[model samples]
Target: MARAPADSHLTPQATQPGGHVPVMLAEVLDALQPADGGIYLDATFGLGGYAKGILDSAACTVWGLDRDPQAIARGQAMTEAEDGRLHLAEGRFGALDRVLEERGVAPVDGIAFDLGVSSPQLDVAERGFSFRFDGPLDMRMGSDGPTAADVVNELAEGDLARIVRDYGEEKKARRVARAITQARGDKPIQRTGELAEIVRGAVGHARGKAKAHEIDPATRTFQAIRIYVNDELGELERGLAAAERALKPGGRLAVVSFHSLEDRAVKQFLRTRSGDVPRASRHSPDPDPADRLPEPTFRVLFRQAKKPRADEAETNPRARSARLRAAERTAAPAWANFEEGRA
Candidate 1:
């Protein structure tokens, strides 16, 4: 799981030197309830914050997975320090079931996913996850796929507009796309700073004026491009399904999402799998009994998603947007039939 910047008051004064603080650590622990001799999975495993927390909480084993090779390399010392209690794997969380199966691991007692770009990814300008510092427009989370530069330079204006509008939820998507296409026509847009400037010019001009304390005009565009470059939404969908298959009955699942898109996906998945779907009104016709839905595979742990305390949010700006949702796996079989219908 990704950790917040190391400035939060929630961090232990005696925590390992240079440790990154996991967001909502106490709440996540409460949801997972890690116990002795049990196994847990830290599906994101960025900087090993959640994994370390789980290890410190109980005499349990933790399987850490990350798509980024750099993250896996960073975890080597932690794995060794844990005396074989922590195992690190390099793979996307969406393929977690396969990763565990290849290792001959059993179903886990709990799983945690901290979604969105990690702090390191955002802080390192060379990684291109943020425009805060100038860098190449390469936002691929893992090294395998196309970069944000590829999307910005190669995609059609309409396609770019669609991505910004759909993924970023930006209202000025068309203007942004037009600006990108016009600018790229002069030369390939290759840097984060260049794109940020283009977006700011486009949106800022449209607004005619800027207000103090307003968010950067380029924030949504950057978010949209990053999400597109990483196929984040699709990965989240697959990861949730994989988690369903990997978890044991009564096993806990906790997901922390940083944005509405991710949080909505998590919320909808839990609601549908837990049979919390909306009921039909009296005016609606009843469906045939033979078309009955499959048994619920999960039970939601909370009626609503949890947010960080005001103090924690004040201390760490990153934690302000975090939303946590948790649920426990049911004995019912994985939702293979249900997934097919939905697909």
Candidate 2:
């Protein structure tokens, strides 16, 4: 998983399926260093962007996994057309090992997860992922997921406040949660506009308190609701742990996260697993090489996470938030700073 020399390694092939140009494409190829005849896993195969790139970079086989049936419907065609070299499965990325085993596939040479909602999902009004287009209050990534409406109507007031503050980092969480609880009591807030208006009314004066902020005051609240309903953080913790076990020695693990919340988890996971101590604390003993921990089970591939280059930013604005980090599997499994409930 050490960084590849340059973008030349990806080779110029048609990886941009139907104008769905992926962000930080060159950087991903450079980090992954995909080799010919390798088998890789695209753990979050959103519209097959990264999966297609991996397949084209070499004669490599790819296993794409996603919980959304719509994505699977688009990707199954690739598997069919490629004569099964490209396989798509419908499941959570956290269940990586089980799906691979069921497919009779062995541990792969590399695994990558692109953590973000797809363009199609956000652009489609009926999907309810974006506030730009009003629709039902349904922000579930999976077709069969518990929609945002279900969560807003069902979760207790204390739980709702906690979710908004923890996931969204919104200071006025109590106000918004309480407002929603009272509003929904009058009638079900089934539409996106209704909920957005409710959130706006709840936090009417707080909007002027923060600078460097853009978009409606409701953005953070919506994000919190979506994260809670999807159980995204829980999925990430489980998925990362699973990916660690599913790679062979020297196998690469790369993740491109779209926000600080996700980046913190990915960065900390690699750094902590490297057996590097979190910044020295007041409570503990001094340093020791023996205390330095056993040879780390995974070798960190990047000294720091990679950000989008200038040129790529112009082509795709989404690249702005992306932070890609990678690591390589080393010796036998050694449990390190990886936590039981990082989410």
- Best candidate, TM-score-wise? 1
lDDT of 2 at 20: 76
TM-score per model over all chains: 0.93, 0.87
Clashing pairs in 1: 1-45
RMSD, one per candidate, in order: 3.3, 4.1
Clashing pairs in 2: none
Model 2 error, position 196 (Å): 1.4
Q: Per-residue lDDT tens digits of candidate 2, residues 133-156?
A: 899989888978689989899889
Tens-digit lDDT track for model 1 on 1-343?
4222233333432234355667887788778888889999999998888888788778899999999988899889888899999999999999999999899885889999999998889999999989899999999889998999999999999999999999999999999999999999999999999999999998884365667446788999999999999999999999999999999999999999999999999999999999887777889889667555678989999979999878777767788899999999999998784563253
Looking at model 2, report the run of 10 residues with the lowest lDDT sum. 1-10
lDDT of 1 at 60: 93
Candidate 1 residue spans exceeding 4 A from truth:
2-19, 205-213, 282-285, 340-343
Give the Cα-based TM-score of candidate 2 against the true structure: 0.87
